[model samples]
Target: MRAVILGGIARRVLDELLRNPYRTIELRSARNVLAVEKAMDEALKLFLTYDPIEDVSTGTEGLLADLIEAKQLEMRVPWEESDEREITVCRAKVKLFGLGRVVEVERRERILVAKVRELFPHEMNMG
Candidate 1:
């Protein structure tokens, strides 16, 4: 496993991961989108975690920045969990840009995209 820290208290997290007795994961950092694409080319699984930013509507509260799509990714929800269903599966894909090259990365897993709608009602229109 590999851990990539992209800001937001990353140094503290790096310290904890480095202390792992098993040494099972590798630590990496991508300073920019181009570097991130290079890292993705060599990665088997990519996990993106987010940190919220300040929002005026919330009065000092922070909300996750809306940058997924801006990062050359697309998320599609075929269905959502409801009383009739117990599980919701989502598909997410990202396009990595290299030096005059483009690579597409895809992952299908159990993710709740519906929550995004609740969080960004003004920005999300899943219709």
Candidate 2:
């Protein structure tokens, strides 16, 4: 299938690029780029094996696998600014799924903060 061909090539390219550090100069300072690319490559490879109808479904399933790991960490630990940081960090892992956009994450965090404030108005005193 088309996806299988494309995905196979992409995976090969990614593997070669990763194996050759010289190719990652663009990502020298931003290691997250590598992580994002790797995830995308994986999603593409997985997409290749499924029919068009199953593509979206399988992609979402793979994406959720990443998200569930993040959620587990979020629940297991005490909430702190660092926890927020962890969420942001974990979000990068799902970027390849095309569903975890930065704007969406920001909006979600803002909504969560607002809800928490409403539930505990006095928890943080502006004064």
Candidate 3:
């Protein structure tokens, strides 16, 4: 799948490259939005595994990121759990950029997003 770098994320990625010389990452815009959405829909099913309504807005931030990053394109949800009344599902599609001039992130219950560069854990050089 082809991807696109939003605006300014090159320098940060370059710096990261220096740290992890062996690591590699690529970003490009999606060739087809509909297809991505379709894939995301299928990916959403994986959320059910973390069920127990009380768990919403809980942990599992990495679940979504890991799925798309892991490339789990297809999944299944039980028919009984498909009903909104039985289970409420919330999801968002996120794209990770290999680099960025500045990373904008919001972390409360979980890592809302870490766009353009490294902003996870927020311990070192998080400014």
Using TM-score as the measure, which candidate wins? 1
State the TM-score for model 3: 0.18
The order by descending lDDT is 3, 1, 2
Give candidate 1's TM-score: 0.20
- For residues 39-89, could you state the per-residue lDDT of candidate 2 as single tens digits? 354442111111122122222111111211111123233466344433322
Q: What range of 10 consecutive residues in model 3 has the weakest lDDT sum? A: 44-53
Provide the global lDDT of candidate 2 against the true structure: 0.22
Where does candidate 2 have its weakest 10-residue lDDT segment? Answer: 110-119
For model 3, residues 30-79, the per-residue Cα lDDT tens digits are 32222234435454211111222232232322111212432323335577
Off by over 4 Å in 1: 6-30, 52-92, 95-127
Each prediction's Cα lDDT score? 0.25, 0.22, 0.29
For candidate 2, list the clashing residue pairs, or say none.
none
| lDDT tens digits, residue span 1-127, model 1 | 2212122223343233324312122222223233234335544222223221111111111112111221333234345643332222222233221101012222212111111111233442211
Flag clash pairs in model 1: none
Give the residue spans of candidate 3 off by over 4 A. Answer: 1-69, 84-127
Ranking by TM-score: 1, 3, 2
Better of 1 and 2 by lDDT: 1
Highest lDDT against the true fold, candidate: 3
